[model samples]
Target chain A: MTFQVILVLFALFAITRTSRQYRKRKVSLYWFLLWTGLWALVIGIALYPTTADAIARFVGVERGADLALYLAVVLLAYLVFRLFVRQEETERSITQVVRQIAVQHPSKPDETH
Target chain B: MKTIALIPAYNEESRIAASVRDARSFVDGVVVVDDCSVDRTGEVARAAGAIVLRHVINRGQGAALQTATEYALDALNADALVHFDADGQMVAREIPMMLEPILSGEADVVLGSRFLGRATNMPFTRRMANRLARLFTLAISGIALTDTHNGFRALSRKAARELTVTLDRMAHASQILDLVKVRRLRYVERPVTITYSEETLAKSPSSFRAFGIVKDILKDKFFTRI
Candidate 1:
């Protein structure tokens, strides 16, 4: 019962944060809705454990916890891939800026050491 | 034609001066892109009569080459550009030979082929590694050539302006081949000698880094829009 209470509280806190981000224009409406829905689903599952069991059984998984773990792993992997792609784009942009600076103000050939 | 030799140098103070001097002999002008070297590479290259372009931060050899190409083509108004290495592995005397195809209007780009001429003092492991890299490049780019990664190359003004090196590292060599094929640029390979010293040999990328190049190329090929 204590664990359920903690999980519900955590989900509520996450929903509140997501709403605040949406209000501050930090997150898009689509993202805010998606996150709020995710937390709401989490709260629902925490409040009613049998819902997870029903969904897990429909998905051919034996345990609700195992289904959550699988989804978390897949989601984390996708996020990691997105971060890697973003990093590469950032590095390319940095190189472009550096190249522009280097080309614009080249050192004169006659400049002595 | 106003041929400018472009040398991409890092922390190569000891060899930059000599490389600049040698390359200066063959081309109308020498431009060295010092990729934020910690040593006195930029000063030495400038002293040796190369128009020095200093990167505020170390981008990489490929990025440096792109910078040099832009400067040579735009600022210097060069008719042709030669890509030379600062490590003294590539022979500066072969600049004209590489430029011949471009000068004669036979090809837009001319690549140096060490396999056709000689890679003197090349270690056995390095030779094997280069051979594997050659095969891998052929597989990826679908353009077969004797040497895929030789730094010695000459490009006409049009080719220099058109072919962009976006990879920004050793993978840029392979990316160049891919561009050559995709752009349908006329390219020819010329025999050029490479004299590898102990320092240059030590500076060569490890076999493990080959995997990184492969990964980068694959990502560029599929994940990114060219």
Candidate 2:
């Protein structure tokens, strides 16, 4: 629960810093939330012998949750990469508009204007 | 000042006429660069008494800007170029204020920021979006601005000639920023009002469209190598 709350705060900070809308923020937040949750879920199953044995028996997997956490984190990172790239592209676009405004005039801002 | 308003319009037939008519009140002349719009955008802009140049097809906003800037710079001999949206969102009076810095030789490029200065009826979602966009641009271009994606802006002839926008779509904004940053262009942001319409709000991008915008930006960035 604490991890989830921290993840939410991190998501907010990330969204506020980026040029995307809150809707985008929400999307990114969920993506991160799922990423963290899946890993946490795997960790809980692995660290706790009782939980690990029960899940392993139920899922009928020979491998334990430690391997699952590692695989999940790697896979989720790749999935999240695309989102990060898109955010960067949007940032690049915002930079372009500001540059045009900056390049054409080449004057010190007077604030009075 | 000998200012030519360069309006890059695409399939904006439904709103171009009003835009041209409203713009005539402030600008000395208007140049409408139609991006190969299949609708009556060219005809309407022309009928509204603007010097309309129609693209053979929808080439995108950057192409329109390049075409119009070339015309305004070479043929029209304009002192400054002001780019406006054909979506009927910007006010005409803002043109004079946008150019004041240029005319006074106080700045090279003046961007009209919707979030800065006085604002009216701006939606919360848009306000947040504009703020984020502004911060992103500031980080990338290393120029602090109050608003980043505000469509209304004016540039002096020198700045206009200095620009080399390569993106053929929304990514054009990003490409322009990178160029300015790399080229070290001087720029500033001015407060301007942007009115939202029910029609426009109704047409806001869907989830698919939002993701598609990302794809388009990436595709253009790769194609232009910007």
Best by DockQ: 1
Give per-residue CA lDDT, model 1, range B12-78, as digits (tens).
Answer: 9999999999999999999999999999999999998999999999888889999999999889999
lDDT (C-alpha) at residue B29 in model 1? 97
- Deviation of model 1 at A25, angstroms: 3.2
TM-score of each: 0.94, 0.62
Q: Model 2: residues >4 Å from true position, as ranges?
A: A1-113, B203-226
Q: What Cα-based lDDT does every candidate model obtain?
A: 0.90, 0.70
Model 2 chain A — which ten-residue stretch has the worst lDDT? A103-112
Which consecutive 10 residues in model 2 chain B have the weakest lDDT in total?
B204-213
